[model samples]
Target chain A: MNAILSDYFLPCLWASLASAGFGLIFNIHGRGLTICAFGAGLGWLVYLLALDAWGQDIFAAFLAAIVCGFYSEIMARLRRCPVTGYLLVALLPLVPGAGVYYAMQYCVQGENERFLTTLLHTFGMAAALSVGAMLVTSVLRALLPKFHRAIH
Target chain B: MNDDKLLALGAELGRRLMSSGAEIYRVEESVIRLLRAYGAEPQVFAVPSCLFISLSAPDEPAVMRMCRIPAHGTDIELLEQCNCLCRELCRNPIPVEEAFEQVTHLEDRCRKHNPAVVLFGYWMTTAFFALFFGGTLPDCLSAGLCGLAVGLCALFGTRITGSNIFFRTTVHAALVSAFAFLLLRAGVAQNLEAVTIGSLMVLVPGVALTNAMREIMAGDIFSGLNRTAEVILVATAIALGTALPLILGQYI
Candidate 1:
C-alpha cells in the first residue's frame, strides 16, 4: 500500500492536478477540465510504469504519448470536441523541461560536448513523443471513415 | 445576405479560430465546411498569421476575404465552442445573419476564466509539477510562490503594448530563474533545479511543438514548418533567458 501510494498514486494525482491547472490557464473549464486532468493523470501513470518496466526514458515517453493520443482521440469523439483540447495538456508532464534548461546551461558554460548531448537527448525525447502520438492519430484518422460508415 | 457578406462572415470565423490558437488545417476545414453547408463552395487557406478565403456559388461571382490574425493566447474553451458551433451549423443550418451573430458573440466573450482562477491555476500547476518531479514538500511550496510571480507577469505582460514575444519571454524566464536562484542561495529551497524547472513549465512551448508535429503528420507541411520555427524561436528565447541568470548567479 505504501509503495503504491508513494510510487504510483501520489505522483499520478499530482500530475492530474498539474495538468488540470494548466487546462485552466488555457481556459478549459467544467467537465472538460476534469476530463483533461484525468487523461493527464493516466498518461503520467503510464509513463511512470513504462519507465519502471523498460528503464528507458525515451521509450517510456513514446509509449505514454501513444496512450495519451489514443485517449485524446477517443475522448474528442465522445465529447464532440477537437483532439487538441485534450492532447496538449495531457502531454505536458513529459515535455523535457529539465533537459532544455540543462542544455542551455551547458551551452552558456562553453561545455560543447555536454550541451550537444543534452540537446540531442531533449530533441530525441520530443521526437519520440510526437512520433508516438502521430502514429496512433494517423492510423485512427485513416480508419475513421470506415468506422463511421460501419456505425451508421 | 449577399455572397460578399457570407464570405466576410466565413473569414471572420476562420480568423477567430486561428487567433484562439486552433491548428491551421482545423481552421481551414471549419471555414470550408461551414460555407459548404450553407450552400457555398469555398476555397480556404490558413496559416498562423493570416487567412485567405474565396467563396462562390452557382449564380454568384467569387467573393474573397483576407484577414491578418494577431498572435493570441491559447483558449481551449473558445476552440471547443467554435468546434461545437461548426458541428451545429453542419447538422441544422442557420441563417447567415444568425450565424454572423453567433460568431460575433463568441468573439466578444471567448475568454471565460477569470483572473483569480487563472492565477490559482498557475500556482497549482507549478506546485504539483514540483511534486511530480520528486521535490519535497518545501520545494512544492516554494515553487508555488514562484508560480504566483509568473502568473502576475503573464497577467500584466499582455497589457504592455509594443512588447515583442522574444523580449517578453526572455525577461519573464530570466526573472523566474533569478528568483529561484535567490531562494536557493538563501537556503530556502533544497533542490534548485526542480524548483526552477517546475516554475519554468509555464513558459515551455509544449503546445506549439505538439501542434507542429501533428500538422506535419497530417501533411500540412507549410503550417508544420511555420509552427516548428515558432517552437524553435520560443525554446531558444527561454533557454537564453534562463541561462543568463544562472550564469550570473554562478559568478556571484
Candidate 2:
C-alpha cells in the first residue's frame, strides 16, 4: 500500500497540483482551476496505467489525451465556458518536452542517427496526443446537440 | 440602439475573446450569436492577430469593424467571463447600451494573478514535473530552484518594451539550462536531463500545438497553419536556447 501510494498516487497528486499551478499562471480562478488540475491528474494516471500495460509511449499519450479531451468537454458544458480553458492546462503533463530537449541535444552534438530517432519519436508522440484530443472533441461537437435534445 | 453601436459591441466582444486566447471558432461563433440576438445578420472572420465583424439589420447598410489585436498573454478567467456574458446576451437579449457597458466593465475587471503567486506556480510546475519525469528528491529541488529563476525572467521579460519574443525565449532558455548544468556540475543533482527538461516544460508551446491541431481538424486551414508555424517557431527557439549552454559546457 505504501509503495503504491509513493509510486502512483503521489505522482498523480503532484501532477494535479502542478497543473493547478499552471492554471494559476494563466489566471484561472475559483473551482474552475481545481477542475482543470483534477483533469490533468486523471489524464496522467491513465497515461501511466496505459504505459505499464502496453509499453508503448505513443499509445499511452494518445489514450491519456483522449481522457483529457473528454473531461474538458464535459466540464466546459457544465461550466458553460470555452473548452480551451480546461483542455489547455490538462494536456500539459503529456506534452513531450523532454523528447524535444534530448532530440535537440543530439542534433547539436552531431549525433545524426540518434537525433533523427528522437525527433521522430517526439513528433510521433505529439501527433498521437493531438489526434486523440481532436477525435474526442470533434465527436463531442457533432453529437452534443443531439444529446442535449434527447435529454430535454 | 443603432446598428453601428450593436456592430461595435459585437466586434469588441470578439476582440476580447481573441485577445484572451479563446479559439478562433469560439470567438467567431460568439460574435455571430450575439449579433443575431440583436436582430442583425452577422459575418465574422477571426485569426489569432485580428478580427473583423460586420452586422446588418434590415433597411440598414452593413457596418464592418476590424481591429488588430495586440499580442497578449492567456487569461482563462477573462475568457470564461466573456463566454458567460455572451451566453447571457444570446438567451436574454439586452439593449446594446447595457451590453456595451457590461463588456467594458468586464474588460476593466479582468484580474492578473499576483507576482508572488505566479512565481510559486512556476516553482510548483517544475518541481512536480521533475518528479513526473522520474527525478529524485534532489533533482526536484534543483529543478524548482531553476524554475524560480525562469519565473523571474518571465516576469521581467514582459516589462521590457519591444523585446522580441525569439530573443527573450532564447535568453531565458539558455539561462535556465545553464543553471541546471551548473547544478549538475556541482553534484547537486543526480540527473541533468531530468532537471533541465523539468524546467524547460514550462516554456513548451503545448497549448498552441493543441489549438493548432483542433483548428486544422475543424477545417480552418489558414488559422491552423498560422498557429502551427507559431508552435514550431517557439519550439525551435526553446530547443536552440537549451542546446547552446549544454554544447558550450561540453567544451569547457
Candidate 3:
C-alpha cells in the first residue's frame, strides 16, 4: 500500500494539481477545470503503468497520450465544446520539459554528444505524444458516428 | 443576399476563432459550415497569421474578406463561446446582422479571471511542479517565488518583453533562471535545476506543438509546419535564455 501510494497515487495527485494550475493559465473555468485535472492524473497513471510494463518513456508517453486524447474527445462531445483545451492542458504533465532543460544544460556545459542525444530523445518523446493523440482523434472522428448509429 | 454582410459575418467568425487559438482546420471548417448554412458556398484558407474567405452568391459577383489575426494566447473560454455561437447560428440561421453583433461581442461576454487569480495559478503550478520533480520544501517555495515573478512579467511587463514571441519567451525564461540562481546563492533553494525547470514549465511550447500535430493530421500541412517552426524557435529561445544566466553565474 505504501509503495502504491508513493509510486502512483502521490505522483498522480501532483500531476493533477499541476494540470489544474495550467488549466487556470489557459482560462479554463468551472467543471472543465476539474475535468482537466482528473484527466491529467489519469494520463500520468497510464504513463507510469506503461513505463513499468514497457521500460520505454517514448512508448509510455504514446499510450498515455492516446488515453488523454480519448478522454478529451468524449468530454468535449458531452460538453459541446472544442477538445483542444482538455487535450492541451491534460497532456502537460507528459510534455518533455525535463528533456528540454537537460539538453540545454548539456549544451551549455559543452558536452556536444550528450546534448545531441538528449535533443534527439526529446524530439522522439514529442513526436510520440503528437502521433498518439492524432491517431486517436482521427480514428474517432472517422468512426464514432458509425458506432453511434449502430448503437441506436 | 447582402454579400457584404455575409462576407463580414464569416470573416469576423474566422478571425475570432483564430485569435482564440483554434486549430487552422477548426477555423476553416467553422467558417465554411456557417456560410453554408446561409445558402452560400464558401471557400476558406487559413494559416496561423491570416484567414481568407471567398464566395459567390447567386446573382452576385464573387466577394472575399481577409482578416489578419494578431498574436494570441490560448483563451479556452473565448474559444468555447465562439464555438457554441457558431453551432447555434448554423443550426438555426440567425439574421446576418444579429450573428455579426454576437460574434463581435463574444470577447465582452467571456468571464476572464482576475489578474490575482492568474498569478496564484502561476505560483501553484511552479510549486507543485517542483514537488512533482522531486524537489525539497525550500526548493518548492523558491520555485513558487520565481513563478510569481514570471507571472508578473508576463501579465504586466509586456512593454519590456515586447510583441515578439521569441523575445518574450526568452525574457520569461531568463527571469526564471536568474531567480533560480539568486535563490540558490541565498541558500533558499537546494537544487538549481529543480527550481529552474519547475518554473520554466510555463514557457514551454506544448500548446503549439500539439496544435501543429493536429493540423498536420487534419491535412493542413502548411499551417502545421508553420506552428512546428514556432515550437523550434521558442525552444531555441528558452535554451539561449537559460544558458545566459548560468554562464554569467559561473563568472560571478
Per-residue lDDT of candidate 3, residues B58-123 (tens digit)? 777888888999999999999999988988898889899998999999999898999998998999
Of 2 and 3, which scores higher on lDDT?
A: 3
Residue-wise C-alpha lDDT for candidate 3, range A1-152, written one tens digit per residue: 99999899988998899889998888999999999999999999999999999899999999999999999988988888899999999899999999999999999999999999999999999999999999998898788867532221
Regions of model 1 farther than 4 Å from truth: A146-152, B57-60, B108-111, B161-163
- How well does candidate 3 score on lDDT at residue B112? 95
**Highest lDDT model number:** 3
Model 1 chain B lDDT-worst window of ten: B156-165
Instruction: Report the CA-based lDDT of candidate 3 relative to the real structure.
Output: 0.91
Please give, for residues A39-120, the per-residue lDDT of candidate 2 as tens digits.
9999989998999999999999999999999999888878767788799999998888988888888888899999999989
What order do candidates take by TM-score, descending? 3, 1, 2
Which candidate should be chosen as best, given DockQ against the real structure? 1
Model 3 TM:
0.97
